[model samples]
Structure formats: structure tokens, C-alpha cells
Target chain A: MLKATIDAEIFREAIEAISALVPECRLHTAEDGITTRAVDTANVAMIAFTLKKEAFDTFKATKSEIGVDISKMKNIFNMGGKGDLISLELADNAQKMAVSVHGYHYSITLLDTNTIRKDPNSPTINLPGKVVISGEDLNNAIKAAAVISDKIAMGINPKDQTFYMVAEGDTDHIQREFGKDELKSLSPVEARSLFSLDYLRDMGKVMSKATEVEVCLGIDHPVRFSFDIAGGNGHVEYLLAPRIEAD
Target chain B: MLKATIDAEIFREAIEAISALVPECRLHTAEDGITTRAVDTANVAMIAFTLKKEAFDTFKATKSEIGVDISKMKNIFNMGGKGDLISLELADNAQKMAVSVHGYHYSITLLDTNTIRKDPNSPTINLPGKVVISGEDLNNAIKAAAVISDKIAMGINPKDQTFYMVAEGDTDHIQREFGKDELKSLSPVEARSLFSLDYLRDMGKVMSKATEVEVCLGIDHPVRFSFDIAGGNGHVEYLLAPRIEAD
Candidate 1:
């Protein structure tokens, strides 16, 4: 059993963050919050999202797991007005979830968890390089890179104490460097990785709304992006596997 | 020889109006202004556009005809900022038209006039039923109708002095009525015609920017939409052949 009322904007942000990586997810709900961890079909990217009870205007739930169609949720949320309160309710063992927003009632059938892939265990890896920057800056670099190439390389220069993104094209390239003055913080350890622009573009759009995002990296390792949402009451993390650099 | 300087927005509007009907057109240039009349490949619709000298900041030309690719022009204009001035220059007998906007110079090779379809002569048909309404209102009705069906029926109710648009779907229908209070003017002649939504949707988008759009209709006849652009110095008329209404 679960019942919750959340601001439409916050709910939209949360759902969009997950939908950027996966079409559906098994969401775990408890008295304190809800969380989901899922990987894209290609297994090239993973997204983990958590929304605390504090993010909601009203919240009540028993520990439970339910399958959610993130894409459908996105469509329903698209119809809602900003700042509107969206109420969600599900009876114990029910297969359909009820969502009401702006006088419109949506009854969505929950996907069967048995048909979904079991949640993967969070992998442990050592990523020494880290940087915190405004989400707009990160997204801007992603967009600029996309204009020139289908892949982007992100790295940290320890000596320069700067983070940089580069996309090389057939005859030209685009590069953007964020120095200490431009970033909120940086722990510059030498690290570099190449990533596919296809995934980054979607992730960038969702991350752009965040005020600040923490990016973690390592040599030839997957990149991790962490950001706060719902005024810091909710959190989202994206882990994208690196693409082999073709010299 | 032709040389003209016009506001980017006015040029964009003219190009968009022409592009809605045909991909390329034989544009006629005179000392006084420029004009184009072209029918879509399917010959189901035709567009006539005229831009008077008053619409341009400066205008000079001889009697000439040149084929223009409307889609290419749209791309070049997309780079311009609002209120920017776009200049066009064509030397006598030159194959390329020079366009300069925002300090960028582009030489576009003109299509051969012989390769383009000859301008269609405006058909003579009496459309007695007339209604002058806000462009936005007319466009809104077109959009609403499109949501339900691929064709719309427009008619004027003589006794009630109302112009109505109706679209029927498999199981439902949507109708919008514009009474005298909602229209700039109305000529209540008993008239009704069915038209394909595909053509109206594109035309509606362009007409939506006009303050007023004059719609002329007749039973079993084509519909004619007339509107002013470029601050009334320019005029555009769209004539769409009606689709047979299967009982």
C-alpha cells in the first residue's frame, strides 16, 4: 500500500531522470522514501533515483516493490502544470496505480516485476577524480560536442586543476575547459574516458535542471554523475560505461 | 538585376508561406515588387504570394523570373536573429543569388526556371460565403479538428450568421463555431465544403500570425484563405481543392 502527493515539477524531474536511461524500472517504496536502480537495454548506462518522504507534501507507504513504466509516467506528467500537486495511490497488491493531477485521473497498469530483469548490484570502483559544476555548464558542453561528433572525451588535468570535454570530428573539433573559477569544486586527479554522445545527450537534458552536479571519473572507467533534485530532498545518479577510443 | 534589403522576419514569413505549398517556385521579380504562384506537386493546393516594395527597406529589380528552393532559404534564414536585416543581391543573368545576414555571406545557386513547374493560373470560382476572423482562432480550430480526423468540414450557417468547422472521427466529432461577436465580419451564405486537414494544418500555422484572415467558401468548391503579412505590405492567398465528402 502506498499513497503520496508530490509537486508535479519534482515528480516530473524524478521520472525524467530515470526515463533518460531506461524505459521501465522496479521501484522500491518504504515508509521513508522510494528508490529505483535500472540499466539501459544496451547495458551502456545505469540510473539510480531516490525521492525521500520530505520531497512529498504527504507520504505513506509500507515496504513494497512495484514495477513502473517510466515512459508512461512521463507522458502523464507532461499533462500536468508546474507546481500542481499530483496525488498517487495504490492499494496493497493492486496491479493498477491511480494518479490524479489537475482534475485528470489516470489509471496505469503496473508492469509485472517477474518479467523485468532483477535489479543489478551497484558495482564498486575506485574513481579518484571528481568535480562539481553547475548542471547548465555540463549540459552546454555536451550540446556543443554533439554538434561536431558522436562521441566525447571528458578528462581532468591534475596540473591545470581543470576539467575538460572534447569532441573530435573529421576535420574540426570542439573543446570546453572548466577551470576552478568556473566550477564549484574540483579534486583533480589525472583521469580521462570517452563516452557515446547518444546516451550523454539524454542524460544532459535531465541534468541541466540541477543547480550543481558531482561528476566522478577514472582512467578508462565509467563516469558517474550525481545531482540533487526536489530542492535536495531527492537525488539522481547516472553511471555511463566508457566507449573504447578508436585511434 | 535585383537588390533588396528586408527584415529577417518578413523574409522568413514569405519563404514559410511559399514552402507550405511547394518546395520550389518560379519567383517573379518586377521593379515594383516580387510575387510567386505555385501549386503543390499533387495539384491539390496552390499558394499565391506578393511582397510590395513598401515591405522592403530598399528594393530594385527588372522584370525577371528565377527559380528558388524554399527549403534551402529556410535553413539560411534560421540563423538570423530577430529584427536582423537580410540583404539579397542578384546580378543580371547571374545563376547565384547572394544573401548576407548577420555578417555571413551565402551564395545560393538558383534552380533553373525551366525545371520548375509553370505558375498555375488562378482559377475563377465564385465563393460567396465569407468570414473574416482572427488568425489565431482559425488556426486553433484547425488544430483541434486535426486531433480527431484527417479532414474538416467548414460551413456558414445563414440563418444563425455563424461560421462552423467540424471534424468527425471514428467514434466522436469536434465542432467550433464563430459567431459575429467572435469574427471580424461574416457573410452568411449557405455554403459548406470538406477539405483535407493535411493542407489546412500547414496553412493554419502560417495564418496564425496574422491579425485577421479572410476565409471564402462555397459548397462543392475549393476554400480560399487570404491574409496580410509584412505589415500589410505583403499578401498571401491559399486555395485548397476540397475533398469529396463520402456519405
Candidate 2:
């Protein structure tokens, strides 16, 4: 038996959005494991999820710790019957997890919850430069690029006081500019990066709830965007692999 | 110069959603004398699309018109550029439309606009019964069924006060019952029908923004769902052919 308290709607929405793109079902037992992978037919994307084990209750050691189908589990979670608290009970001899959300209860059996190995080769570059901007601005930028190109090139030049996104295709091109006034603050440096449009779109889908987004970037490096929600304790950090374009 | 104002966003959204599904590029003009098409994929998905009369937008006043690529037109319309008011001006001696949305202006050359005739057939027969419901509820029910089955059976019985959605597949089966409590009202008789889940999903997508929806039904007959949005001034209706069940 397990019980946890969380910002119900946000958590459910985030999980639902991520599960739509992720295909695998691997739940890490560690509280700080952070990133998880759920793969599907089209492409595999990483979901960086953070939940303090303290958010849960009734501490008891269980012999069996398992992963559940992320998609189905997310669907059941989103049905939301319990309210602020979510309760999970695993039948003693069965593979099903009795999940209760708000007041509604659903019993969903596990469809194979094997643990997925982490991508060790994934870059761990420390990003020092950051900027804060409106979520709407960034969301629109990503969405616009999504139409013309599959990769978005982001450039921030503090000295020049400009932020730009350029999406170029063989036939059409789109460029958007955001000035220094729109930025919360800028760390001085000329840094640019690129990332896949699909991942950016996925991140934008969930992060649309945030009014302000903190974006950290470095040239030829992974980009991290953090969304502060649920009074700051609840946070979602998205790390996207940069696409290096040859000059 | 070309400019048009559509009063409601719901209409634009519905038209975009429906048009995205159909591959045909050209549409008959309001007078049916001129046929027009936009070459942008995004604009095709959006309403209030405008293009300069060019080799592409050229339609047969008494001659055959060019056929434009639909996919591209849909993109520009979806960009939702600043303007609720749209204006389009032709570039003299050039095959380009200077499009304006709000203050945002962009010049786009036409690819090819073909005047194609559309054969739209509305379902015949007066449905014997009707049900009124919130579009949100219906969309959710169909979405749930879509996850489990490709085809769903919808049965309405006013006599017994029941509306049922049943979907059966090799591995999964779902039957959802919406009684009088869930529905605003139901006028029923001896009427039941089956339809493709794809079509239902599309219909639901088209009516996603609607607050209240009216569903007209008849046994073994086409189903019609009408959305009354923004105080009934806005109307969107979808008629779908029925799938006769073996039993």
C-alpha cells in the first residue's frame, strides 16, 4: 500500500503529456534518479521526473518493487478520483496495482515493467549561461519553428542583447527575434545551440502551464529548461540533446 | 487585395481540424463561380487564408485553374499570426501574396492553386431521436473508447433511459454507460448504430471547443452531431455514415 500527496492536476497533466510521446515503462526506485525513458515506434524521448519520496506515506518495506505501463498508469492517474492524495495498492499475489485517484478506483494489471538502463553516454555538460523568459514567447517560438524545420537553432548573445531562433528548410525559412527587454536577465556570452523540434514540442506541451521559464544553454551543448510550478517545490527540468550543425 | 473576417475562433478551429484530414487542396468560392486554394500547408488548416491572384490562385473564370499544394497552406493559418483581422495584397508582376496578420506581414509566393470541385453529400433521413450533451463529455468518452477499439457501437434507448458506448477488441473491451444523469436530455426510440472509431474521433476533434452538443440519431441511419457555440450564433455539424453490425 502506498499513499502520496502531490499537486494533483499538474502532476497528472505532466505525466499524461510525457506518456503520449514515451513508449517504455520503467520506474526507477531511487528518489533522485531523475530521468526515465519510455520508447515507442516513432522515436524515444527522455522524461525527467522528480518526486520526493517524502511526498508518500505509510512507510513499509515491500518485497516487490515494480514498474507499470506508463501509458495506462498515466491514463488511470489522470482519471483522478482521489483529490490531493494518490493511493496505490498492489494485490498480494497479483500483478495489478489498485490505483485510486480522487475518489475513483481502477485496477490495472502490469504489462511488463522492466527497468530500462540509463544512457551513460548522454552528455552531462554544465550550462552556466541562463535567461528567464515568458513561457508563451518560448512556446510560440518553438511552435513556429516546428512548422518549417525539424531542428531549431537558438542563439543568445548578451553583448548584442539579442535572442534569436532560426528554422531553415530547403524551400522556406523562419526567424524570430526576442530582445533583451523581454528577458528577465542575461548572462554575458555568445552561445548558440540546436535541438530536435519533436522534443522541444513535447517539452512545450507540458511546460505551457508555466508563465515563466528558465532556459540554460551553452554553445554546442545540451539545453535545459526548468519550469517552476506548485509553489516552486514541484519542478520539471527538460534536457534536450543539441544538434550540431556544420558551418 | 483580399481580406476576410470570421467572427468566431471556434469556427476557424473546426474548419482547420476538418480540413487537415482531407487532402484535397482547392475549395469552391462563396459564389461557386471561382475556385480557390492556398499553397501553404499550415494556412490550409487555418481559416481566413488569403493569397494574391497568381498562376496558383488563378481559377477558371471560364478556364481551368491551377491546383495548389494543400499541406503548406495549412501551416500559415495555424501560425495564428497577430491579426484577428487578415489582409492580403498581391505583388505587382510577381506571384506573391503579401499577407498581413495584425501587424505581422510576410510575403509568400503561391505554389499552385487548383480549382477542384467537392462532392459533399449530407446524410438523408430524419433522425427519430436526439440527445443533448456537453462536448467535453462526449469527446472524453470517444477518446477512451478509441484507445481500446477501432470501432465503437453507440446505442441510444429513450425508453430505458440509457446511452451506451461499447467497444470490443481481441485483448480489450470497454462498455461505457451514460444515463440520464450524465446527459442533459435524451429523446430516444428503437435506434442503435455503429460507426468507425476514426470518424468519431475526427468528429470529436472538430467539436472539441464546443460547450454543448446535440446528437441526432436513427436506427441504421447516419448520425448527426451539431454544436451550438457562443450563444447559438456559431454552428458546426458533422454527419457520418453508419456501420451496420452483423448481429
Q: Candidate 1 has what TM-score?
A: 0.55
Give the per-residue lDDT digits (tens) of candidate 1, residues B1-247: 7999999989999999999888899999999999999999999999999999999999999999998999988877876889899999999889999999888899999999999999899899999999999998888778766755799999999999999887776533556778889999999799999999999999999999999999999998999999999999999999999999996
Error of 2 at A129 (Å): 4.1
- Model 1, stretches more than 4 Å misplaced? A1-247
Task: Give per-residue CA lDDT, model 2, range A1-247, as digits (tens).
Answer: 3333444665576466456456445444343322344434433344455544443443232344455566666655665543466555654445676666667777877655445443324447788777888887888788877777799888787777777777775555566767788787777667788888978887787677788888888898878787765445445666666877964
Interface RMSD of each: 9.3, 3.3
Model 1 DockQ class: incorrect
Q: TM per model?
A: 0.55, 0.52
Each model: TM-score of chain B? 0.99, 0.69
Candidate 2: where is the Cα deviation over 4 Å?
A5-7, A17-21, A29-45, A53-65, A81-84, A90-96, A102-104, A107-115, A119-122, A244-247, B1-71, B79-107, B112-247
- Relative to the real complex, the DockQ score for model 2 comes to 0.10
DockQ of all models, two decimals each: 0.04, 0.10
